[model samples]
Target: MKRIIYYLTALVFACIHFVSCSDDEVEGTQALSVASFYPTIVMEGTEVTITGTAMGSVKEVVFPGGIAVSNVTCIDDRTLAVTAPAGVSEAESALVLRSENDEVASRQTIRKANPAFLSYQFADKEGAMTGSSMTINGKDLLLVEDVVFTLGDDVVSVNALEMTRKSNTAIKLVVPKDAPIGEGVQMAMSFKNNTSMTLPAIDIQKGSGGGSWVQKEVPVYSGEPVDAGSWSGSVQLAATLFADAKVDDVIRVYISDCGSNPQGSLKNGSTWVGLTDDLEYFNIGDDAANGYYERAITEEMLSQMQESGLIVAGQNYVIQKVSLFTAVWVEGGDEETTDPITPETIMLNDFEDHDGHNSSWDASWTDAEATEFPVDDNGNVYLRLAKPLDGWAINCNHQDIGTVANIENYVIKFDIKIEAGVTGASEAAMQFVLADNWLWVGAGLFPETTDGKWMTVSRNISDLSAELVGDLAIGKASNGLYGGVIPAGVCIDNLRLDPKK
Candidate 1:
């Protein structure tokens, strides 16, 4: 009986040992989750925050290759307010959470930001001008006092008689007129706390120094309507040559000079060639620093802008140079007499070279016949359609010659004024054609078929069938003189030949 009792007691002791060991193992195990911020949070930054958590105890918080956390205050049992001191490198930093017994959890991310200034943009009720004085408007400018503008260490100081607080984001100041032009143009605005920003380019003219527009008759070109006038390539017709805003506020057409690249800078689109396959929307060329539109097309393209074609087979083409108020169609060339396309043929070949083939339109004179394409004092001309059109199409043989490889897209940029009459119809507002090797390939694009609105249109170049790269054209479809019948008016302006990049 004594021996049996001893065996049972030993077994019980073994069970208790196992249980205690299991409990110790659980306590020693650790887990942690650390917060991550894509752009490292600066000392005083307040945009976004990500946190990392550990299942076990946390000991020290270390920043990878950066300044260690100085004053860490425990907000609660799980949160800590970590202070990132200044003077750390502007590189990525890893945050590590170490627990007791050497267990640790880490997160790799950008270093916490410092209070370094980035830039300042000065503008006011009137507008941002060169002579206008403005100050800092962002956060963490508390220690700012005297601001210094610099370029690559060149310092220029502006006297601030008053730093009026227009709001949390703006300050008013008085700038010296004698400030240097080129060097002082781009200033690095530094504050008393060492936090500074680079100022943006400012405009000098606050008001229109030029005179108002005056009615003056302009000579019409031989081919153009009596009301239409010719604008030579040499003239900087900022104040004189203008289409009716009602017909088209934004110009989608461009004129190029001889020996110039047909391709212009394209904004809001792709860059590389032969690789891009999608052409969702069109964009315009990059605008210059000045608000006025400059020469965007090559000289060669300009020479071909108004090419006349004789109808090879069909009825005589009624070619009239009337100012299009709204939507209208223009053909690039007459159809092939030998190859009459039928419904059995693919849609790509249906409209090939159909320039001014079938379209009709209306024209209105913004200023009476007293002046041809009215000119403002600054040589700026303003013409717009009295009403808007529902839809329109284009077919031009102008393609970007600089494009060499697999042509992926043909982009066009213009403004659409819906309120004037451009109404967004169903799936028929805008459309485009795509081709490969000059053979019928496909047709995929959205055509603008709305009334009373101004909008930008960009059709995919790959959508055209039968040709992938080479010559291209744009136009509309109608059943009138050349498949164009205008019920509503649509203005077109600022035409551009935008390359993907």
Candidate 2:
């Protein structure tokens, strides 16, 4: 009797399974339950497979933007396929599946792919360390407001200011300074309306690796590699990299390290050719300062050099390394505010050593005559600017900070003494220049140094507009206006940025 009952039950279950598979239907009003789905996120018009119990009855798939895809197909009694429709918002929302007499929505959210991050491709295909650069390639990446990395409760973010938006499909970002590290480090991109999605894990390697970016090199032509130390070859710089570089930027093509290596001849991208027909344009001149040939890189050259970079093939010159050095500026304004300054800082440059902690007053723009390092009556050494002559009156000196610079709460201190008889002693001002913005820290902002006496001047940069600076200068760069009031004989000493003590 028991065997007869078991046989009857097995026959009934087999019949129900066959009926459901053949007709793509389930018994009346069966509660649909989702087991799982592959690729919870996808690009529009991409197909997705959903698996669940009683899913054969699904007749349509409704996307977040209300596009009802009625052409859904059932693979079997427990599987269905639907292609995502276009014109849907790229955010997390319910994927509703509709059947003849039932509606089942996924318990987990589904979203359309956006900023579609393809991979963590570094320039060299390796660097994934702090301060090194990595590129995120995808569609509509401009929608990403901030890129975030998190490990447990610790979180670090790199914003748009720190990233270079190469194009609609690519963005380059240097790893943030305080980024969290370890296995299972989660990465996510923040979009508008607080929408975010979990992405593949990123490995933030330990130890020091930022050197790849700080003193990094660019690409060289491939073919016959120039004699390792030979200078008779070509160098190429990507357009997007130096397109925003300012005039007077110096490119040194040398047979040394800390720059790009000379490969073939001066050529565009891959084509072997010069940017212009001028013979002097290809003439790679020698630099006495750094023992390399230097060329003034201007916006015009950049336009032509976008693809091919500069060529150093003049007379079989065996140059090996190439470096592009940019000049940083300091700007100030006439506006002054009254606040008690709590002085603190780190020594940047004394104008005596030309070296400080990660900062230096590079003498590329001047010589010992115009900028003198003289000992005072008390044997105190100081830097002085000689009066402007018939030549360009560039009294202002530009200081170069290393790859890392002191930021907010870190104030720049300058000890200054302006000759009382100078033209604009009463209105004497200092300017800080970065990129295109100019900030002028006028008289009342610091101290009255025009009395012909050295006075310590300090400015808290935390409230300033700029976050990091490449260089700094004593005065403004106005055709010749600054040379008038800031006469030669102005003395400066003890220049540095330090934490407020």
- Scored by TM-score, the top model is 2
Assess each prediction's global lDDT (C-alpha) against the native. Answer: 0.29, 0.48
Highest lDDT: give the candidate number: 2
Q: Give the TM-score of candidate 2.
A: 0.31
> Which runs in model 1 stand beyond 4 Å of their true positions?
1-119, 125-392, 396-405, 409-415, 418-424, 427-430, 433-453, 462-487, 491-497
Off by over 4 Å in 2: 1-114, 122-127, 191-197, 212-501
Per-residue accuracy of model 1 over 1-501 as CA lDDT, tens digit each: 000000000000111111111122223333456644322544432222224333224455555454554334332222334544555445665665555544443455655443443445543365434344455555444334455544444454753222322222334443333334342355444543345566554433332221111112121111421110121111111212232221111122222121211222212112212111221112212211111122222222222222221110001111121111111111211110011111111111111111222111122212121111223332223223343332223222322112222234333233322233344322232333222122221221213442442234443445534244432322221111111222234333222323342
How well is each residue in 52-142 modelled by candidate 2, as lDDT tens digits? 7666677777877777888776554566667667776667887887766678788877776666677768643555666556787676565
Question: What number of backbone clashes does candidate 1 have, counting pairs of residues 3 or more apart or in separate chains?
Answer: 126
In model 2, the worst 10-residue window by lDDT is 1-10
